[model samples]
Target: MAHESTDTASENGPELQRALSNRHIQLLAIGGAIGTGLFMGSGKTISVAGPSVILVYMVIGFMLYFVMRAMGELLLSRSSYRNFSDFAGDILGPWAAFFTGWTYWFCWIVTGVADVIVIASVYVTFWLPLIPTWIPALVVIAALIALNLPSVRGFGETEFWFALIKIAAIVLLIVIGLVMVFTGFEHDGARASFLNLFNVGGGFFGGGLMGFIMGFQIAVFAFVGIELVGTAAAETKNPEHNLPRAVNAIPVRVLLFYVGSLAVLMSVVPWDRFDADNSPFVMLFSLAGLGAAAHIVNMVVLTSAMSSANSGIYSTSRMVFGLSTDGNAPKAFSKLTRRQVPRNALFLSGVVLLSAIVLLVFGLGESKGFTIVTTISSLCFIFVWSIILISYIVYRRRRPQAHDESIFKVPGGTFMPWVVLAFFVFLLWAFTQDPDTLMGMYATPIWFALVGLGYLLLRKNPKHQQLRRDHEERIAQEKREAAAYLAAAGSRKVR
Candidate 1:
């Protein structure tokens, strides 16, 4: 059995480059926080939970913010940790890396498929009702592959603009909505005022406890890509300086982008009035008699779908690349092009993404297909996030000195990770309460079973056995060095 290269910078080929500047990192973080779910799924969420949907977004955001902070502390703890997969491998053993890496890859692939389907079925068909859904789907798949192949910076640049468009659209919606509320704008004799939120159908919880619980099933998918900052941490130019900044601002982003936007939308349109199948953004503008602006809002929502798909491609490729380098995946994926882009992994994801075309051309029906993919994507993402928190808990027990010396500790410390994990369990229970999501929940275990089987077979390979040996040796060496350094510091302090 041959020993694999532990060097991230391979002696035989190029590695991923640190081309993403602070601006790119900031926007990538923002883009990950905002997903197509906000624009496309918010209508359904509002219908399900009514005005209380605002609180759902805030609570989910708060929980995920702690997950990001835990990730930030772990990534910053060691420069060698390319992402959570690396640290999971380092701290928990090789199997953790294998499962986390492949699971995260699958998570994004599911998300990308849904994004492309929405682009083709919902947005493209809006303007070109006569065109086949597969046309735009294929076009989007090709364009995202091309956009990412050029460089990491290209992906960052694309996300920056895509995210900016989403932000502008939301800000414009909030501003217009406020004006409507203050002026007592009326349509069908229902005045647009702040009171409308609680005054409508059932008040804040008008949907009742059951409806509010169902809101979690719909809204959790909106935050699926929030951990992307962890994936991009290695490629960030100044990770220590920039990663915290990117993470610390998540609460503000959630409040403004998700909570703030939804509040204003519900305020202007009244929660019960929003159509579950239509974008609340489009509805808001259309009601204001801004037909042209409605079209523009439609375009922004279109770009938002594209952005999510684009991010899916970028993160999946990078994750597979990490898996390959760790000997969890094929060697070919570990090889990078001269541009420092993982071309092979990128093409693989794009090829798989073309499956969306089949779904589009066949008759899954846009709404049903979108629901299936988003449900599965949301469930898989929860698994990935739980792994991050689990790894953090392990890191804390193993490295208390590191935690004490850290500046960006998760606010509630070890206690908070347990709380968030409990919240996730409640979310899983919420899924069973709804038939649409329950099907996905039942289907999710098949994926894990397959991955578990693959891991079992890979574990038997001589090459993997040797790599595991090397991985254990590396962890032991790192522990010895850290202990020596801490002992020396203690001695100097005594003097």
Candidate 2:
């Protein structure tokens, strides 16, 4: 296949320029994956599953690796797939594109809100230990909005550093944990061994079935940003090379940072003693006699939250931009600023995020904010993942030649898709298994119904109809041009 051309010059101004480098793409992926979810939520998972939380993370990480591999294969197979939504549309149908794009957009919007809440909570440590949480929540929302409105690279660079801080912190924790395990340093005058893996409850599956299932509740959060690499494909300098490398590294990173660190943590302190309300990393630092452990961990968690929110903005804006380009959203969103950034779409996302702050101000508590936003975000992820599997299934059936030629094919291609689909269905069922998540599960279809209604209303608009027609025409024109070029090349060779 021909390499995809970087045609940003055709765009109106600097706004459409492809400015991202390999460093940016790699860091963005890292930032997107390591978020507040890992920092704060892991403690809950560990508490629930004890030592079994490690396996829960590993299993989820395994499944997500295939998901990313499937995405990578499809993306690398064709230059036209700017992102996963485009691939969904091309491989499945327009409805797939529409649903996947908007669903993914809504996903990040909710996730961003959750991050905003987390950021507010983190700030409360110093600002107002007793003040109502909503005050800081609103402030955080405003600050994030201001940061996002500038330019895409500015956002990318900021996220890069935010993610870097979290990455560095996690690395340091792991290294410290390893040293303590090997050298028995700070073992409180006792020898520390690698026996913590089984010390919690006698084995790796220490938590049993209930603990395992409960672990999934929080473990899934760690994989939240795994799909983010696909979102940055369009902006990467060399997506074919960088995208695959970045995506492939996900599983290893999960195992190392999540499973490895959690193992050491449980070893250092018994699983039963792990605190659910606070970060285990912070707790570990405190146990290790670090004076500023709480403050340092708080700083790391704050950066982690910022990283997640920044990625949420970037991914949501791109999804909206892709939707607008495909005639699913307003034309104004498709209009890129001089920097090649989707300023209008980014601004709209900021507006939605700001609304979450408004909700907070009106007495939406932190727990409520998390449930409302994270559940909504999770629902969107379900929709996006479902589309990918469905599209892969379609690609398998309709385009056997392409399937055979794919460079990075999803293993167990035919059967694995069904298995993954079943896993998703199980997750949806799991959500409904509990009263808390049940609400989110029920809320998902309502969101879909709203999207359907909006589509119907917008379909009637003359401008939207015209844009759709124009997009279709453009696709046809591109195909014809490609075919003619191939035909001319064939004729020249024959002559």
Candidate 3:
């Protein structure tokens, strides 16, 4: 209930330092774009969609690219904007910020839950074998919070190494898979050839319509963290250059990491042979006569999940800070530690993550409840993406001059949002094709309704109203000063 603070330093200053560099931004972008979804989830994608999973990854990448561009342009439009929530609030409304900010927070929280729980299982099964999974899950959650509590650079460095491992794994897979394919290497009496892709069981579209549709459900999860680049805009020095570079490289990365890896993987190990429950990378390594493949792949998967959970803590804490700054959340969330990280928000986020461990304790998680939770998380992300596109459209309509002035412009400005939106609609329809995804879509409304109710409640608070009024007034004042300065400069030039 208490909103005001004697500590107004952050309110009047640039609270977060720009400690992330080009390399940090690049690797973080890669880490955010790639997840355990590629390493651990692709087997199911290959098994269910057959070779058509290639197209599924391509399509998802294509659509999400526009979303990232729109986000990049939006973030670049204003210097003071910390994340999408700031621009959303200024252009769309406080309500947009309230919803999008919280929804994004919800997104990473859900994702982190799924990641930590899986990491816990991996620990218990592979290393501890005799210990309870919940213990490991708790340990992971605590460790992420500790790692993140230090500084933003720590988070960046952590992701740098994590992303490096993923890149190494993919490169290794592609190199080895290509060699086997070209040499016609035989594994378990099955020749590793390009023909292995379509020659086994069913051809290219082996799974047919339903199979391809199912790919979207799993493949979408691979892209859940891609937009995390937007959240980094404020922390990256020279965001104009760094941010666009990160967003633009996504398609190429998708091609290499998703399409390339999967193509080579199925070539090495036939799609039919890929276990939906296991990592194809490990399988190929084992077949390549590497006895330590399982252990190595297990380490990669654990690191991949740890990277995701770490990102969740970083993202959710920032989002909560945004919400709190906008008077949409508790003021405690805005408290920044000496290190400039949102310590209180991070603490609260980790505290809530215990629910993930709880879910695992009750016979959920790993593959069973994980599928459902991730589906719902995917649904939340789709909503957040839609809001960004919609916000971009509004920005163009209401402030075309701002778009004209933007340095890193989103190509096909006016028409692209519609294209992205339509693609999203198609994806939603695709979700309807499967029971699990359909349930996720159905559950979305309830989440939004709850958020809307919270918005209404927050709007009623006197302090919230005052903050909104002051925020609008501040914008108006800045606009007037800019216009007057431009007019005086023009007159002086004419004289």
Candidate 4:
């Protein structure tokens, strides 16, 4: 059976043990998927497609459901599949593993930077009204690094409560919005009608074809961390059971939290008034005559940003650790502290997050930082998704029997992968259509080119080459030994 192999002599620490429980896995999955992007960006999506934004979210959710299912089937096939990167290596090639691991690491780093920028802005709005935004950004980075250095469960617990707050806030907003829809308390005495879905629109596709298409840009952001559940497989108490449940529930949770909430927002307020500058949740409460609504929403958004940053720290560390194990990163990264956490990797990720603070301080403003980081992260997500599809294609071709045995398969398997690939291409095209996103879209290819160059350099490293040969020799020797053992046993039985 495939299982994680520990370097016993390399690190003798309390942290090297798996300590996370099923509850931690469940909540971490929730926290990972629910980020500030959904909380703050949903209004912009609504502005784009008006009421049809709901459909955009639902469609994206449906497609991502299949993606998660694919991941689940792959992970469950072998106890040795530590994470997606391992699966990528097994199914695709060593190079695929190197690319997937590093790409994912970079993705989290970029997303963490975005979260830092946003979190700094939120803090600036309250305590440090006159302080330069970068100060708070640096402080937030330092604090998160401190938190993560302790233990994995510490990170998990923090994220659990952070996610719980956001979940509770959304539940409250949904309940209140429903009441407003039914009771007509804040509707200016107009009867609540289901017709609101179509009544306030310039038709359902509110911004026309352009708007409908543009909705994917925002819709995809909400699904950015959906794959995070797969990362927790290594730490989960019972991955075979917990993973399936978490994977299956992604679609339903996304529908309830995204589509359901948007439906209420449109019913209570005209979709046109769903401002991009402020949260729709605050708008709902403000319209309902609550004076403290803005502050309340700000608190929720704060937690959302923290949640994203927290997840970034956790996922990036694991990615780096995976890379280290594969000889694609510095060996020191795989070193764990007493808590079984990759302390070196965690510190490195935190250090990278400081770039966000620097961007806020010396380069762009906070808003610009958010834009740049988010765009880069989104592009990285596309890269990761593409790797998964490529890996799955290879897995199916190489192990036809194993592929046939998967209980949970990606629906429409071969065709759907192509369709999703095309959809991502369209999203890239749409990114270029807008002036704001065009530069970021162009920057993405440059980023990949840099990664490719790095891979070439790593490939040439003597140490890495030796490690690769060693790993191959080890596998071949193991196979030969197994065959010999079986032959000897058969001869004895014949005698």
Candidate 5:
């Protein structure tokens, strides 16, 4: 009945349409896993940890795969739940709804800023060295905003092609890299071989224990958008079927895309050879004397950055719209256009994106600006992800029947969430080891303090209090109905 209410557009307001198909969901998930971070940030990570960065990626991917599993199970548990934020509000409380929704919104904005920086500084400037960086930054922001304004399906189709391009590029890199390795391609007298992963540089832990720990700082950012599929839950068609299919493929995607590609990259060029500011994908072709291929890869990386910025704009708007509808944000954001696009919320994110141009104008060079922005983005996303895991734990506790009936239960049973949380704490400590990331870690709490003050003020509003009361009652009623239905079903089976 609740699902019915959401799908039926009201005369008073337009509801979000379930326009994203199975293919859209699948590609979007794949696109989320292969982010701009890999294209641009891997060079920094490789430089810091050498060949050990490959292991670093695998570990981060391993932990995040469980996080995705928790998210999948939570989304499938209730058909009426719009996204993780909806369940967070219902199960954790109103404070969580406000915090997680807004934090996740900020998460993408920060990530979009990083993506725009990479687009302008790393990829675009690679070709147009004489142009002002802000020119391209502004152009990218405008193009993405226009791409998202028409309809949800337009965004989906755009992402689908963008994701396809990224896949093709990575596949091409992996293929070329393998051919070079097998053919004994030599770069500066270092032969292309699997042994190159360890034989050169620091030999695995090239940067030492601290370097290995530091690898996670940038590596985690690479996985930031992996959960975009969870945000797209409401728009996905046949979510129960498609969501699991997409999520279940995460491990394979991580291995092939992140681990497989990086392993080959280091073998072909060795981790020490990568320049921190340059994209290794571009570097690989350039070093191999394939200038045309290098240019092509640069274009692919450019689109990869655009794809990430595109996801940031789309996810941020949907989140603000959800927050506004639930009385967590300004009501204007709740308003959707005739095409079911949240124009107000969309522009809000686009406006915040201008901060990218400011950073550029101030002369924050590619390497420094990206490090700072990505560090902040990684911390915020960890909070968003931690909220999802916590929400899942609470879901299992408060609604045992729902867990029992869940067709897609999270693996490792109830124990894995705590394990993943501990790993996040390790990552937090990793941030402190680097001065750049530590600066971001220091600034992150200011955001929470500000949001905390906002929450206090929000609670005093009489209208908000009434909305909270209504939401609490609805959640209680839904639980009762779910328990009763499960009981009846169990009795019928026994009889």
Candidate 6:
């Protein structure tokens, strides 16, 4: 019904089309959630957490599954709400929308920036070792902008293929790992068996308190884009039906790709043998005796990192488009192209994304620069996910009837939010443990301060006031329509 209204083409401009199909939505969620964190960064994660990282992945996965469920329910409850920020604004206030929308935008902007740097730096080692690193970075930015500019479906297609490749790689690794395990494969004197998990090390908690704490610090980031599906709900076909499926698959993904892969890696190669500098994926493949193992792994991670940057551009553009429509950003950003794409928003994001090239030029080196950017980015994502959880709590309290009647409800209900909230607190404490992560914690306040300053300045602007009023009016109108629909249903039942 909301799509029916926006698709009619009013003065405000055409709505974001429902171009993402079920498969597209599912893979987009998978693609967004699984990135360099698992592919490239997992090597470091395993080096830091050892076998305990497996539990870290599982625990984070368990908590965030409910977070996704809560998000899935909220998006389905109101079609008029374009994203979590919109519903957050509607349910919490305009201020919540302003904060969440812009924070979400900034979150991806930082991530996109970091991703491009990674793209360029990784290029030097692999495909274009002879080419200038910045060249590939520029080419990737330009190419993704082209893919995104055409239509939502075009972006979906690109992401679909990207996700497919990652999935195929993961599945292949798992299958090979299984073969090695069954045949008692030995590589470089390390025997392939499940017992290697505890036998070869100081046991499953191989990493002591410090290692365990850092595990949360590192592993939390891998789950950063887990909620990306919520952002795409507006452009998804039958979101009410498709979104839940996407969200539900997160646990399975975590278990198979993360927990399963790590389980096999540690089993095949001793966790202590895992180098912080190398990919566990590459090492595993090389151990399994792929002659071109280095090249294959390099290409897989290259494509994976590129896919992540592409997702950042796509998500950031949409978020800016949402923010603009909400009157929190420039009106130009809300303007759509003939294909219903947000050309202005896409450009704004791309220009900002180009800043990543500066990191390449300045040469903080990808290792150090990526850590700094991703740390801040991860903290920002924690803030965003917390808002979604808080919004869910508010939704349950204010709209009990709506929650009661929903076809797709979060299974744990009121209790899980508290449990997840505690997990977040522990995670924040975990961030305090390492100097690098602690530095990120300290850096986070500057962003909030800047946003607060912006909010204060925008508060007095007539344009912002008008946007606020428009958003409230839209929410009010949806309430009226929902009431009428229910009334008609009641009448039909009486007859």
Top lDDT model: 1
- The C-alpha stretches of model 3 lying farther than 4 A from their native spots are 1-14, 198-200, 466-495
Please give the CA lDDT of all the candidate structures.
0.87, 0.74, 0.83, 0.76, 0.86, 0.82
lDDT of 2 at 471: 51
Q: What lDDT, from 0 to 1, does candidate 1 have? A: 0.87
Which lDDT tens digits does candidate 2 get at residues 296-400? 888888778777787888888888888887778877898776667888888898878876656656656456546645766776786787787787776666555
Candidates in order, TM-scores: namely: 0.93, 0.87, 0.91, 0.89, 0.91, 0.92
lDDT of 3 by residue, 1-495 (tens): 111222122457428779899999999889888888898889999889999999999999988998999998888876777888877777666788889999999889988888887787764579788888898888888888888889999889999999999899999989989998998998777898888777887888998888998788788988888888788776788887898888889899989998899999988877888898888988989888899998889998888889889888998988888777667788888877787888888898999899988888987775555666788898899988999899898767655556657777788877978988898787788888877777777877887899999999988899768767866775575467556766776898999
Give the runs in model 6 whose Cα sits over 4 Å from its true position: 1-13, 463-495
Model 3 shows how many backbone clashes? 0
lDDT for 402 in candidate 5 is 72
Q: Supply candidate 6's per-residue lDDT for 19.
A: 91
Q: Per-residue alpha-carbon lDDT of model 1 for 1-495, expressed as tens digits?
A: 111325343445446799999888898899899987798789999999999999999999999999999999988887777888988877778889989999999999988888888788878888999998999899999999989998999999999999899889888889988899899889877888888788999899989999899999899988989999899987999888999999999999999999888988888877888889888888888887896865797799899889899999999999999888877888899888888999999999999999999888885646664676778889999998999999999778667677777878889886999999999999999989977788888889999999999999999989779868877887787578668877887999999
TM-score, structure 1 vs. true? 0.93
Ranking by lDDT: 1, 5, 3, 6, 4, 2
Q: What's the count of clashing pairs in each model shown?
A: 1, 10, 0, 7, 0, 0
RMSD of each: 3.4, 4.9, 4.8, 5.1, 3.1, 3.9
TM-score of 3: 0.91
The order by descending TM-score is 1, 6, 5, 3, 4, 2
Residues 123-181 of candidate 5 have per-residue lDDT tens digits of 78889999999999999999989999999998899999999999998898899899999
Candidate 2, position 489, lDDT: 62
In model 3, residue pairs whose N, Cα or C atoms come closer than 3 Å (at least 3 residues apart or on different chains), thus clashing, are none
Misplaced by over 4 Å in model 1 are 1-13, 365-367, 470-495
**Winner on lDDT (4 vs 5):** 5
Q: Indicate whether candidate 3 or candidate 6 has the larger lDDT.
A: 3
Cα misplacement distance, residue 373 of candidate 5 (Å): 1.9
